[model samples]
Target: MEEERLSQQLHEYALWKADVARNLGLYQNFLESQDNEDNELILRIEDIIESLSTDRIVIAFVAEFSRGKTELINAIFFADYKRRLLPSDVGRTTMCPTELLYDHVSKESYIRLLPIETRLEDTSIAEHKRNLDYWTTLPLQVESPDKMVEAFKEVVKVKRVSLEEAKRLGLFIEDMAQHLEQVPEYVEVPMWRHALISFPHPLLKGGLVILDTPGLNALGTEPELTVDMLPNAHAVIFVLGADTGVTKTDMDMWQEHVKVFSSGGKKGLLVALNKIDTMWDELENSETVASKIKGQCVSTAKTLGIDVATVFPISAHKGLLGKVKHEAALLERSGLPKLERVLSDEILPQKQRIVRDRVINGIGATIKMSRDSVKRNYDGTRQQLDELQSLDVKNNSMIAHLLQMTRKETIIYETRVENFQTSRALLMKHVKEMQEFLNITELDKHITAIRKQMEGSWTTGGMKKGMTQFFEQIRYNMTQVSYTASKANESMQSIYKRFHEDFGLVDIKPSILSMHHYDMRMDNLAKRAEEYRDSTAMTVSEQSFVIKKFFISIVSHARDIFAKAFQEVENWSKSSLVPIAVQLKDSKTALQRRIDNLQRIRDSKETVEGRIDELNQSLADFEARLKQLNEVCDAIHKPLSFDQPPAEAEDIKQQTAS
Candidate 1:
């Protein structure tokens, strides 16, 4: 909900910024007024928001000249995969970024390559299917976002190959040998630089996202995709070298930017502190090194005006299994869930807040404008002006009604954003804490206990009996663990719901503000009609002389009376508060009619967040319980090698008592 909201705000602000820029250009030519930097800053905020919204992460194995970017990607995303998105080597591996999306159906699956020069009107594709010679070098193109996949299939993947054998598919023995054995240079091939690659993955439901970006030379020399695709992805895992934290080039990339014109706004930005294993190897004290690395990340986040929670430390290369820690007993996969949760929960909610803020700001602007206009109308009454100026700066008074509204609205806007941010921060912090609490250290302790128990069980029960009992205990534990997971999941949903409601989310009763406003409007309209009827009705041909000559005068009198009435009310109320009060009252009535239409935006956001939180908790508990349930099943059915029946019973007793 928050992410959707932030995206909405960023988009709105982005559009507003673009419109402002367009107007600025026109005004420069026609009005010849000097441009205000302050105004430009406001517009830039919107533009920044837009940039954030459109960002699809493209992490170019960015390094100086050649620092093994392609090698890293190949190792990370494609080592186990059946198909290679792009042929990689020590040099010139990726001439183009092979963007991989998912395409479920499309019998004749083929590769589509789109050149950078391909226009919106041009619908062309360079396709190859099963033919290894042609498959590796096809150009892809598409006319619109609508046919992006079709273009990808036509240009990147082989079409209608039907899982043909290597020999039948005419796979070159030499090419296959070259592919298996690393060479100095990647195979020379024609590239559709702008083309995207779409194919199916065996494991993941959404399929795998493998972005084969071009060499640093092309990316730096002509930075198009970098700008275009950064904000598009759910998260960008910027793979920097652990050996070098922030080189001159890295700092430059962070600092120097193109003066790109934005029509939208910027919102979500995340940083990835990658390649920690290299630092771990370099520094003798790995703990000290890791601490320093985390500190550096915090410092970097500060420099970039982003949250540290947005930063992720991922050993993508290590996770790919190219390098495994000998000392480690189990797989260390810390960054995956961190990245997923950051994108899905934290980043998502921030985007939503940005959207809500935009709406509130827009309303505030209207209120401020109305109040400002009213003040200007009655500007220089020395006594009145002096009296009006003497009120609390933060009060909900007419003296600063519009300004106060602006601030109040900003508070309301920030409230949700702040809550989401806080929730995200707390959520991530606790999850990480959970991981740390049940880390390798915890596992090691359990393994140690199990080892001791196993020896005792072997001494007591015969090998056959011990083994059977252990298996039975494992099964019993698993069942109990599953039960615990189910219970925790149920509890979490209620907890998340309470958090959501605390932030002003409650029953779905209709808004009374708008209905009251409508009633007020009807009453006024009826009174006016009755007054008109009491006066006189005359034909156009025989109109009353008084009516004909005094219509404008009558309106003027009524308006003047109303104004005076407001002025008279100023002793108790406020002089500037009239307009905002009118707007609120009017808006209230309109809002009641379309209250549902007013967008329960915050409500929508909280709902998604609450649900996600509940699911995540359930998943965590489910993981823990499954482990226990397996142990229980093993205890009941068969003897286990890991622990004796007494040990299993001890654990189960403690759990059941809790």
Candidate 2:
């Protein structure tokens, strides 16, 4: 029964991951054409949508130094973990934030990480010698557990003074040095803001992601990681030492930082009174010491207005033996199991309900985002339509006006081109200057120790090659990812920006303006996506919102006409609108090309994930096949020596001689 149930869980995780992948593709497509004013807000929405796919229930277990955070996780849920025990050496098992992920792929186990500021390939020992600021912002995938462990050993041992070390470098400022002093002494990833330890847990692999972060002060606090990562968590097991009680730091972590999310957000704080084994070693009356500590932990939780489930008194160092009497009871009382139930049986299902709400929320959210994006095309179209309204376009009267304008513009272009040529040169120079802000290649060197372990594996070789090929394709695709129904409308914006000095044509300039919807093509692509999405939203429903169907129909019809006008980038110089219209139309074609490319990639991913699903069954099949082979190959007795072979041959020879 349990085997079947586990198989079901594995299956569900696979489906869940696939569903997320599908949603991610949707978000990726939505994000591709973001070429205008509302992009920042759109990006935030994109972030929410993106998080919905990956880090939905990121329950981070954070604590101060040597408080037994790993032990606490192990104590509550070690029975069915990928391994029998959590990795603990010397004192701390985690020198970084070890994220325990329930990887829907590779049902067995995986430990992954996104490095602080380095891409994998560029990160090498030599790079570390240069400086800390050279790393890229790209995500880094750590190798398998054994290899990651080897690399981690080196990362922890590096002798260089961390950024914190420099900041706290004043030899006399021992007391004043706040963040930096924690780095030189602590065993965690010395320089990084957060070190990730991602693996498959028995319980969490069902649907949980248990993050074991290093001691807070020693690890260095990155507000982005906390701000982005923590609030998304479903529940937080804030582990503290029962023996030590709640320190000022611990109290601050709970009261100030943690409470921010407890209201309407999915995240909440739960205190764990870990390392209760130390109570037995006390010279002061052990019972009194234990009781006093437990009371304080409860008091701390009460101060925050949360139920203190159980102050678990555990000896995580005891190595999986039966816990002490008090510890065992505390384990039963600890809110982890309750918390797990809340996540799986209730919260998880609740989240599913929201997602499966007949795709209403997803459809609404996506459509709303799309309409706002496409509004620019409407504005441009309206301006052009008003220009045409003055002359009846259907009678070919406006065509003459267009011809006149084009001829007039032609006369001015010679001078405009001369001025434009110089400005364009200056703009290009400034662009190169701004491009220098992008160099993070130096940061990769510090993490070089990890790259060593990735060498010479068959799968690793294939993955490296595959990723290189993928990135190559991405480089090209990024240049022309967005599609539009009208090319002419987009070309106008491009033409306007190209010659204008303010639009950046000549010098080494920072593409800060480019950060906005600088790409006319991108704008057109966004407009196309928005048109489709809005058309979807405005579909005649059983219930009518605000405006009745008649007005909405008129507006909807007007919007389409506006879109047509918007796309008509009729070059006044050109006789027909065909040239620019064809260019805008290419966006649609461009969009289709991208979709085709993305579809092919999706098919490949689907196959890979499908193959990954068959792994356990394949493993079981392989095990049985090996067992059969072993039985057949068994030499229970002795080998067929020369003596035995010769006797059989000699008997045959004797019979022939006789």
Candidate 3:
């Protein structure tokens, strides 16, 4: 039952996300009703809502071959099927990296596989995903476990190819060839490079994604897996064999692929010492067996150089069998419940915090600005109503003087608008300068040059030097961009302060462009490059393979960093002045409306009583909208509760079955 906690937390997280999306929709509708012309704000809200709708919490399972990574996935997520959903028997069952997620967009269950031959192309896997023609598709019959199993067999399929072809695909290694007494003309390689399975499992439908990766060879050849996918996962479960403890290949995978994530305080990195049943001796007592498992876990932690608490000893084999047979005691003995509890308790809350922070920072600030604008308009209207009500129509001199005063106020507002336009021009100039520093086209030029240099190099050392210089140039560019961003921020702050002092305007601090994270990301990538350069494994590998991996993993990631910085700069440029502009426009419109009403009163064309009545109705409308806006804000800020008891796993299974 404790294993159900992960499912329960995922359910609650889904509900919470829906609630936030609903509130965002309400806010978007409110904005549309109030000001249809503020399309920028409306579009921003739409983007946030779209992201919430499609977001997935990705958990990647990484390990060397025969580590039970796939078996663990089947036990934890697919136990309700009463059988193995993924191929997990014997050696090298899953030859390629596989992804399991619900197809929220298509609402169809299917398996998509990318042919291994596509690796010969320059296009990345991410690019291939966008164009379905590159992948072979198969319909998945989720209702029939046997059919699903048969379809999943394609992931483990392999084909014999000439050794030359395998080498060209970057699948051949000299070390692997050296193992043979005689050089073979042909070698077997995975038929597919990647597998994506979309089915309507409850957890998958609740926005959970499971990434099952193959061994080190696959990780080394497929650079995107290490550079992009693993790093982006919400949590990474590195499965280790309890029978072998931490092997050399496992340690290599950890240090080269997974250890960098640990530097971020190891919050989302977890170790699963799988196949603990290997140490389950019939002659030993339960306490003795558990002690051995615990000792192995500690040893694994020591070898991996991580805290022992992060290492969990589990038997994926028994866990799957227990769940299928409905034997709770067997499952308990498998040590799955404790691991599940920690995963649910730690990962879900951390994910929630990340989503909460993004929503608060993005939509929350915009809503506050909108509310302030509405409040200002309401207050200004009330003041105008009070002033109008004080006037006596019989006193023509008083009405004339009031009309003159309002016209003068209109002139002052017009003057302020002109001054704001000049200041805006200066701001735009600074924004242009900032944009120059973040120009993607310029970054592309740098990338092109670096690629040429690396390609022209004859030796591994020369290419490694080129790789180092590539990152150095990128780092230098980011530093320049950061400096320019700071300058632009200063100009924006000055503009806000001037308006606040000269005319009564709200002093809204502009959104800062923080490049520190990107800077740190580049630094990490550089560090990874250095490690790769110094790697004995890479030294033994082909120079061509090394170059391809460097570009795919390191250079591509650096390019992405620059792209994101460019996008952020553009967004900041557009939104930084929106609030003040909205307020000023509303103020000017209010002033004009007052002048028109008072002039009519002075000309004896419209009654003072009539004008007062109109003002009263307008005031009431603003108040009602303001109240609704406040309620929407409250809904957006409301915290989600996760203390409710979880439903039994059997109940969840039945519901999904239905």
Best by TM-score: 3
Compose the digit string of candidate 3's lDDT tens values, residues 476-517: 778887888787888788778878876766667778867788
| Candidate 2 residue-wise lDDT at 173 | 24
RMSD of 3: 3.6
lDDT of each: 0.37, 0.41, 0.82
Q: In candidate 2, what are the lDDT values of residues 139-216, reduced to their tens digit? A: 223434345445444323322444443333211123333446353442223343334333444445555666666664
Alpha-carbon error at 221 in model 2, in Å? Answer: 3.2
What is the TM-score of each predicted model, taking all chains together?
A: 0.32, 0.39, 0.94
Steric collisions counted per model = 92, 41, 0
Tens digit per residue, CA lDDT, model 1, 1-658: 2223333333333343343334323322221231222343244335534543433323333433233455455444444442222453444445555666444444223355554322111121221222233234333332233343334333322222221222221221232345565532323222344444554433111233445555343333222333334423433444445456656555544443211111133434445565666666453676786687788778766755566776666654554443224212111432433544554445444543443444333233322333333233223122222332353323434424444444565456455455544544443443343233223344345434544454454332332233234334433433343343334333333434444464333222211111222223223322332332232221111122212222222222223333332222221122122233333333333223222211222234323334334435544543543443333223223221112367784564343333
What is the Å distance of residue 645 in model 2 from its true position? Answer: 75
